[model samples]
Target: MKKINLKTTIIILSLIIISILFINNLRINKADNLSKAIVLKTNNSNVISSGVTNIGHQILTVKVLEGGHTDSKLKASNHFTGTAEIDNYYQEGDEILISIKEKQGKVTAVKAVDLYRQHWELLLFGLFVLILILYAGYTGLRALFSFVASVYIIWNILIPGLLAGQNPLLLSSFVLVLLTGIIIFSIAGFTRKGLAALAGTLSGLFITIVITIVFGNNMGLRGMTAPFSQTLLFSGHIDLNMKHIFYASIIIGASGAAMDIAMDIAASMEEIKLKKPDIEMKELIQSGFNVGRAVIGTMTTTLLLAYSGGYLTLLMLFVSKNTSLRRIINFKMVSAEILRTLTGSIGLVLVAPITALFAGWIYCSDFFIITWLKDLKSHLKFLRP
Candidate 1:
């Protein structure tokens, strides 16, 4: 086995420690008044009152698993009906989530929130981590760390900032920059290739932002078209500009594909340079273009399919309703999807050439200089001849 580099070991260890601390702190600081309970018995025939629609109750026998009632050995249960059933229908032996209302350390009321499936969800995530590490080794570890960091930043910073009425465009742009730097540098390492990729990605992101800002409004897109956006406003974020959020989402969404193209081209160019140090600048640039061509072909379709895939049901609904093509195209949801896909694809298209240029300049600079001197020498010799 190859010996691990000391620097790499230290970096990985530090990142692991930081991740652990961050996750722990997040859990500790999470302001939620909830507890877990396991259902022992369920009775649906309990009628405490009569109503117009024959309102009944479900008395559930449960045992508290954690939180404020953890110390109580006696079993407990809560009666729920009506709107609570819309949240969940419980069964015996099922784990549930609950919140209790207490007065002077005595429980006044208990509400069953929903079913608990976090254990299986966490297990699935563990499997994903294991598969990633096994498949990609050190690179997978770096990718996982970046993923965690991205999630943490979004949850802790971006969400809170947006809720606090910060400018979504500016905040999202700053986040994109941070994510771009972290993802590229972490995956590619702090090398010339990484820098070239970062530069290319940022350039592509700039183009995406400009294009989105200029055309997104004309496309008649609003953040409210996004799922839960209206709910966000209704839930006390009235100060948020749904339009600006929509535009910012476009840029941020496109940035991932742009980064992919940039890294591909930059890495290709770096490899070509290392393999053929005597290659001319023009040849290196051409090689980068070739690499970009191959990447963008699939990547463009990837963005389109990804954006449209989620709206398959909506498309089917329109088709069933016999919606006209023109109307469908101009529909708010459809238009928003079109704008997102096109803008992201456009940014991805630009990433190739930008990355090619940056990589050629960074990786082939020495050879370019040498090629220039040789051309000058040949020109002088031709003049003499």
Candidate 2:
């Protein structure tokens, strides 16, 4: 049996403890004012109710009673249109479970779903974790732990900080740096490779932020372009700057690509070092640049595809309406999407070269540059003497 290193063992233990704490925290602070209830029945019609607008969509005022172990009886009003598939699943008197929260003595069902109660997704997720642990062992466990940590950071730290009227850009930048450091170190360990990847990732992230901020402002991409941003306004969260939220989201979205490029460059450099440890510094730098060139194209397209996938329906809407190209691209949401995709692409492009340069310099520093130059000078001096 292979002996486990003390550092690796400690890391594994720390991650396991943190994972437990995070899950417990989430469970404890979960929204409890809301109750899950079944949809005993639903009333739907085209006529607009008093104080409600039809808005070209069907309206339903669902009547529900508390479900599960709670015996509490309650009535809730929920808005449903044909847009979501849940509306199609509803039949008169069908048993549908809805999550309802109380406000001012009235219960409002924010989200409702038919509960046949299948744990398939949960089961699959558990199986995935198990397979990862079984095959990859400690590293797999670390990856899972890092993933959990990332989610916690985003939800518990970043979201709350942004909503609490903190500077969105500043808070997001800080979170990105913290998350990158934690994730890289957790997965790659505190080694030269991890440091190289971290440097590249941070560099890419900074460039992404700069590009996002400049163009986001010039393009008039309001933060309200994001889903639920306007709802936050009406929901009485004051002093929350929507524009800053958009800026933060841009960097967060770009960070994944930045990390990818950094890792790619660092990994390539590490391989080159292993194969030829005596490779010249200039040659190693060139090798990293070459690898980066190959990655930049597809990675930028990946960003484009990712951002575009979310807006396919919106694009179709514009086309179906016969909207002009200029107008379609100029729409607030469309413009925001464009800015996000392009800004991320720019970061990816710059990150390739920056990461390659840094990885080359750090990985081959001793023999490739300094030692080679010193040897050359000594040879010349001996010849002169």
Candidate 3:
């Protein structure tokens, strides 16, 4: 009862702290530089025609609904550019996001950036939460809290901190550690199992960090391999280490798989201990190793499939071009994907033994073993009579 109460109190306090931090961060990053707009009309239907490989641009007339030009609803003309496959064609009553420029407290210019689809996004998110709650019950609520906390930390804390020129490796590692502790303890409760899992998870994360740093350097990659990262370097008020960010991403990506294996080993060991209180330490450790082996098989395959799925189009393109297999394997993007998947899978494999050791020490008590042995001796003597 005491343990349960303590866990409950900690969870409540965590939620409160997270709520306060989220609101504060939201205020700090408020969207004051942009105005909400509704597309009134396209004043010029003529688009600047570009080559077949390029997208055309258009001009839009919009009514400013928010910002310094609030409530006036004056028509403003702006340039429009579509992103990826989405056309920047705005029809009547289509709400959109507009970047406004101000000079002398008056709106000088407006540019259409994208559409505002907050309502649809919220509906989808709500449905996801509903499904989780229905399937997992109270545990689902805990998982939901952890998921939201993680997203908030990534968006508000990690991204902002990186933009502020903080060291990506250090900041990211700190956040990963913080998140690992919160998630494991929240779901596993304040028990030996949680503690064991936490230890194993942290160890696995540390291993990943070291491996990424060492191998990332040897790969002769500068992290500019990301298409948008180069553009970001030219765009803003931030100086970032692209390579370090890449390394940090590798570590963070692997942390989830590591934590999963750790928790699984811890839970299985605890269950074994519960069913056989007198189970020897060696036997308990062996049971954990058995569980780890079973999980690692499917988990590694999952990593391979997930990493490959993202690059299916690229693979298809290579096939169409009749690119040699050696060239495709030597490609930078392909190598990076390989590095990420293998490193993460290795971390998952390591977490098993580490967690098994911790759980064995926690759940296997010498007192229980002694009692079981004494009972067995008495039974043997009585059977002789």
Candidates arranged by lDDT, highest first: 1, 3, 2
Which residue pairs come into collision in candidate 1?
none
Q: TM-score: which candidate is best?
A: 1
Position 216, candidate 3: lDDT: 74
Clash pairs detected, candidate 3: none
- Candidate 1 lDDT, tens digit per residue, 282-331? 88999999999999999999999988898988999999999999999998
Better of 1 and 3 by TM-score: 1
Clashes of 1: 0
Worst ten-residue run, lDDT, model 1?
376-385
The TM-scores of all predictions, comma-separated, are: 0.85, 0.78, 0.84
Which ranking of candidates, highest TM-score first?
Answer: 1, 3, 2
lDDT by residue for model 2 (67-168), tens: 443655444444445344343344455444555666776655445544534356668888998999999987787778777788878888888887788898
RMSD of every candidate to native, in Å, equals 8.2, 8.5, 8.0
lDDT of 3 at 287: 94
Q: Where is model 3 poorest over a 10-residue stretch in terms of lDDT? A: 376-385
What lDDT does the true structure give each of the candidates?
A: 0.80, 0.74, 0.78
